[model samples]
Target: MRIHLTSVFVDDQDKALSFYTDVLGFVKKTEVPLGEDRWLTVVSPEEPEGTELLLEPSGHPAVKPYKEALVDDGIPATSFAVDDVRAEFDRLRERGVRFTQEPLEMGPVTTAVLDDTCGNLIQIAQSA
Candidate 1:
């Protein structure tokens, strides 16, 4: 079976949506009310009908600790493959994105990490 959805915890849904869409260029797929918070999801522009990335609320007890652990370890909550790591990094930076790690050669890939401005670091990578 194919994976249909994945989640990434975010401190604020609105901010996360803005960053993911306006800055990173993903398109919103769904936004449904779920009790106090909403179930928000986005998809890549290049793959509109592909798997969704859920922007889960960070305050949820089940995910709080896991999110914290990932941030503490400097591990990105999610990664997006790019055509050119350096160009994407530069473009993102020009759009006011803050990066935690600069582009670096990593064996078979060139990668960089940036703060999503919501709660977690997101990685951008390209084949080396």
Candidate 2:
């Protein structure tokens, strides 16, 4: 089988939408209200019909500590593929995105980690 959707726990949906869309360049795919929270999701503009990334709320009891531990350890919550890791890194940095790890090459792959601004570290990767 194949993946259809995945999620990143966010402190605020609106801010996450802005960062994921305006900065990271993903486009909104779906948004449905669910009481106090919405089922918000985004997809890469280049792959509109592909996998969707959900911006889930961090209101659950275990969310905060889990997210905190990931951040404290410098681990990324999710990774997105890019055509050029360095170029994407530079572009994101210009838009005020703080990166925890600069682009580093490992064999045929390159990756960089950046804070999502909504309590998660996200990575951008490229493969040769």
Candidate 3:
């Protein structure tokens, strides 16, 4: 059993595409237009054939409140694994990305959270 795809709601696909690719370093995998919305997805550059992360539209009525509540409680919409949390955090910070939480160690794991700029917080983590 293997994971195929997952998604994160975005306010704007184009903007999210740029951020995910240019900043977050993911590569575009699929893009099929569907009027006001599109079926877009991205994959980690290092794992281009791995699980896909869909850039879904936040048009659903329930999504707004769900996202808001998560943000209000300082929760991440999703997490991505990194080789080194602190190094990744510094690399992103140097690119002008805004982080809501700095890297913190928790036992054998370290994590940091940052705003996705598309109305969601994303976490980067590393484990020993």
Cα TM-score of candidate 2? 0.98
Q: In candidate 1, what residue range of length 10 has the lowest lDDT sum? A: 60-69
- 1 or 2, which is superior by lDDT? 2
The runs of at least 3 residues in candidate 2 whose Cα sits more than 4 Å from the true structure, single-residue gaps closed, are none
Clashes per candidate, residues 3 or more apart or on different chains: 0, 0, 0
lDDT of 3 by residue, 1-128 (tens): 99999999998899999999999999999999999899999999899999999999999999999999999999999999999999999999999999999999999999999999999999999999
Task: Give the winner by lDDT: 1 or 3.
Answer: 3
Q: How does model 2 fare in lDDT?
A: 0.97
For residues 16-112, could you state the per-residue lDDT of candidate 2 as single tens digits?
9999999999999999999999999999999999999999999999999999999999999999999999999999999999999999999999999
In terms of lDDT, model 3 sits at 0.96
Q: Which ranges of candidate 1 are over 4 A from the true structure?
A: none
Residue pairs that clash (backbone atoms under 3 angstroms), model 1: none
At residue 39, candidate 1 shows an lDDT of: 91
- Model 2: colliding residue pairs: none
Q: What is the lDDT of every predicted structure here? A: 0.92, 0.97, 0.96
Indicate the residue-level lDDT of 43 in model 1: 97
Which has the greatest lDDT? 2
